[model samples]
Target: MVDSLEDTIEEERLELMVSPTGGDPTLRIAHFLKPSVTSIDGPISNLPLDAHSFEDTIAKPNIWASKVAFNGWRNPQKQWKHWVHHMHSLHQSTWKEAGIHEAVMNSTFEIPRNDNLIFAFAEKWCCETRTFVFPWGEATITLEDMMVLGGYSVLGDSVSSSLKNGELEQIHEKLIQAHLQVTRSRARKADQSTWIAKFVDSGSEIEHEAFLALWLSRFVVPASSAKIVAKVVFPIAVRLSRGIKVALAPAVLARIYRDLSLLKDITVKMKTLNGNEDDDNDVRVTSLAPLQLVQTWIWERFPTLRPNPHLIENDAPRMARWDKRKKVNSENVRQAINSASEHFLWRPYAMAANGYLPCKLYKEEAEWMPVGSGLDEEVSSLARCVRVSELVGLDCTEQYLPHRVAMQFGFDQDLPGHVPRGEQTRKIAWENYTRPIGDTVLYIPSRLFEADVTKRYLDWWKRSIFGGHNVTKTAREQRSSSESLKKTVLHISNEKKADNDLLVPPGFRPKCNMVEVSFDDDDEDKQTLAKLVRKIPTESEKSLSRENGKPSLDPQVQSPSSSSTADNGTVGKDKCHVKPVDNSIRRKLAMEDSEKEAESGTFVHDSVSISNKAESSSLDACETPGLDLEARIGKLEYAVAFLKAAKFGHRSD
Candidate 1:
């Protein structure tokens, strides 16, 4: 029956994995078609790669070819493998820094000639610093030796060395090229920043300034590229002020404490509905003890192929849909890979000719693009874990999108959906428009947002706005209001000059000294100096001179002053005192002294003493109220003496 089934499959459920080289092309067989092309144990009786098998009937219960019926989609995995062969065939580059070279590449890792040297070199750079530490899966770097890059450099005796050393031999085959550098992390002082403000550091000055220049040439050039990038620096600044962290990663990921609770609930609900009676006790469970031999065989071949490089929904075998639920034709799967590749190429190709990107972009591209199986990274990432509920036995009756959050979820049951009402099925959208991929990398950190320079600049250029503006910015504005203001002010802010800016008077040369000038049409603004001049006194009226207590009434008078006595009696020099009477002219001095003393005499004692004092003073003393009070008392004393009124005839009036 098995032989009959093999013979029976003609063209009905079959597809081509690779595009046929010659002939009808329509006659190509099922691809990704894991025939016994490479065998582990047995002498393969009927290999699928045979020319005869191309036209002959094959033994399989189900299969499909990438005929027009499959929408011209080829098997992504098969095509991917097919590519690896071609790529490997053309690849030839020798590297010798760490005993790695082209001839020994398969043993260590082969370098395709076109592979980016910068990307290859970057690993060495990263090797120098223990500061930056990415877990194996974080960046574009393939996780082989459990290495991380792009943060603080490591200390010689740091904890990271312990983590990295154990896995070296396993990845002895892989090599990447990239450029990395350390920045001057010292905070600039206000005094030092003054120079930066007057003449800031140029793109040619920063250590990575050259790298930045290269990125801008390729990715952010004018009129040549196709890609999209989305950044929200200002919005991020606003959110950061509210205390969120890591703008590249979402708030939820950073605040894992909050996430763990929801994750716990989800883990519970998923375990329940997805549970089936056949789980550990399915009747179809046969003694796969036969496969135990195969499993052990594959396990022994460690450094060859990783069993689960893509560690998310589909790649992780435990999380994958049961073989029965996989309805996509193998050929259709390959086609998906092809489409993704073409999509990936669009940005790099568009920006490649421009000088902004490094020559090494293509280099890294070669290193990263392995079999088409590796290309599914776009859809298969752990970042796409949100889509996990849809792929298989996952019963998401309870699970919904967690990112489409409009507002936060106050309760546990209603998870904040990221999608809005009008676009319920769509992913959450940014409220603002973004710039093209090319224009974005023109700035410092904006391009840094991406993992590779190629993607960094290419993505940025594609995201440029309509007017060739690369408005998308680098994010994760890390501080609060005061700190943020300081950070942003370092770059001159784009504020418009106010009308009051011109209001700073241009010298003291006005047409007239205040009150003399009045005009009907001058109502437009009341701030002209002529009108405000008198209300505020001349400099002389404001201060007294020490030379004398009186102020000089001249505009250009020079006396902060030694003899200026202000109306309030404030004096500058002369030990800061009031004008004193001159005893040399006793009459005038006495009159003045008497008058001055009278004004301070309230309604009280020593009235006769004032008489005696004032009578001895000059007439100008009468000008002083104390002198008048003294004069009146002197008259009353004389009248009392003349009429003897004080002794006996006193008048109460």
Candidate 2:
């Protein structure tokens, strides 16, 4: 049979009734169609119309009316003072419209006797348009006032016995002031902060001291109940002091502890209501649980064990996010690499050409490259883990699954190298700087890494003003290298000369007259000759004839045949038996010879010259067989000294 849509649906009947057990009691409010203003049937008591004034101008301004009106407004230095002034004006206007100022001054409302009455009073205030404009919620008592209510109300009997008359009012006033401080200041936006922060942030030192005084005001509570008072007001005091720095009196601390204890009890009560203890058989019977009717509860519990559907679905979008991040990182790394290269190499080289060393400048620039590169060490480590996972394949351990899964969707690692771009650039620049510059074997200094006007100024200060060392490290190194190169070049030149010597035939003497050639009179050549003469022996030698059975080389004593053989190179090979003598004896001998020549006065110069030449030839021929080559060289040097004396000594005389 074909049925209509309405016929297929089942309808249930609904009715209004009182609340179930543990729920709020129903309020029996009496609604009036056209009741007179004097009629009193609801929570609000009958107000004396004659005493109450509905006029907006009912209250008169105090002596400091203008100052009070513009209190925060005039303080241009205070943040959000103007906004506070505007809000105050709105509040004043609302108070005037609702006649709340007159009500507060002239009327007194009774505290509800029970929780139901209290709830009803609160609801009436909340729903009423006149009370809706009041701050700190529509209830007559504010959240701050709840502390006092804990002491006065039935719910707070345990702590209430501890509080005395007027103590609750004083606590409420202090709490309201603290709360108002946060709400009035710009710091009000951070309302979640502690009370100390809010209060201290609200005003200056003077205001802080004033609030501290309020906290110190003595309460009427007894000594025994002081502990209970402390627990009840502890949180309020903390809120008051949130942003404020003040010396809290012992009394205030005690009250704060009392308030806190009450709060703890209240919390326990709330938890008891919502916990398993409250899940009684009544709830089970009233509320239907279709899941309980299931034949297999085991299969039903499987859904709870399964992973969250949202989490599984999130993988795709999560990968896409990572892909986007990778692309950005890659771009950043590329830019950093380029910047680092410029900072490391090109910039520094340019600075060097300008005669500036900017190591610090390059260092500062290099430091920035890593920040923009976007690949922190964490991501690089993750990439390593991913690579390890890939190599290990599906058999890889579960620990690295996150990194592997992240890279599974063909997403490149795009991770930076272990060495930072800046460091790499510095390393490269330093390497190139240490090595030879271009084709030349000269190295550029690493100190000359970067350049700027500041570096130039510092260099100038270091050089001109301070009179510091002129040579830099690079310059010193170059100078030492050049000196080494010069020595090497000289050695190579000597090697060429030695090679030339190999072409000369042995025993083939070139008959060059050693004594006949005139010496150059050039100043440099004379200096060179003087140096060589100074190096030759200046001390006198002993006579060989003293130790030998032969006569010495004296023109007056020697036979012509013996002198001829001696002059001929034969005696040059024989060792002379001699003892050491002084230069004075040799000089005296030369003078005597010259005097004798002068005395003879018959061309003695010619004979002396011939004798001198013959002596030189024999000295050269005497190889000094008994002595080493050094002794023979010494003998030749002695002969040269004697010749100089015979020729120059007589002329001076």
Task: Report every candidate's CA lDDT.
Answer: 0.19, 0.22
Candidate 2 ranges with C-alpha deviation above 4 Å: 1-44, 58-653
Model 2, range 155-209, lDDT digits (tens) per residue?
1011112224375446556655655665667754213223334443455433333
Tens digits of per-residue lDDT for model 1 on 478-511? Answer: 1111221010011110122232123225542121
lDDT of model 1 at position 326: 17
TM-score of each: 0.14, 0.12
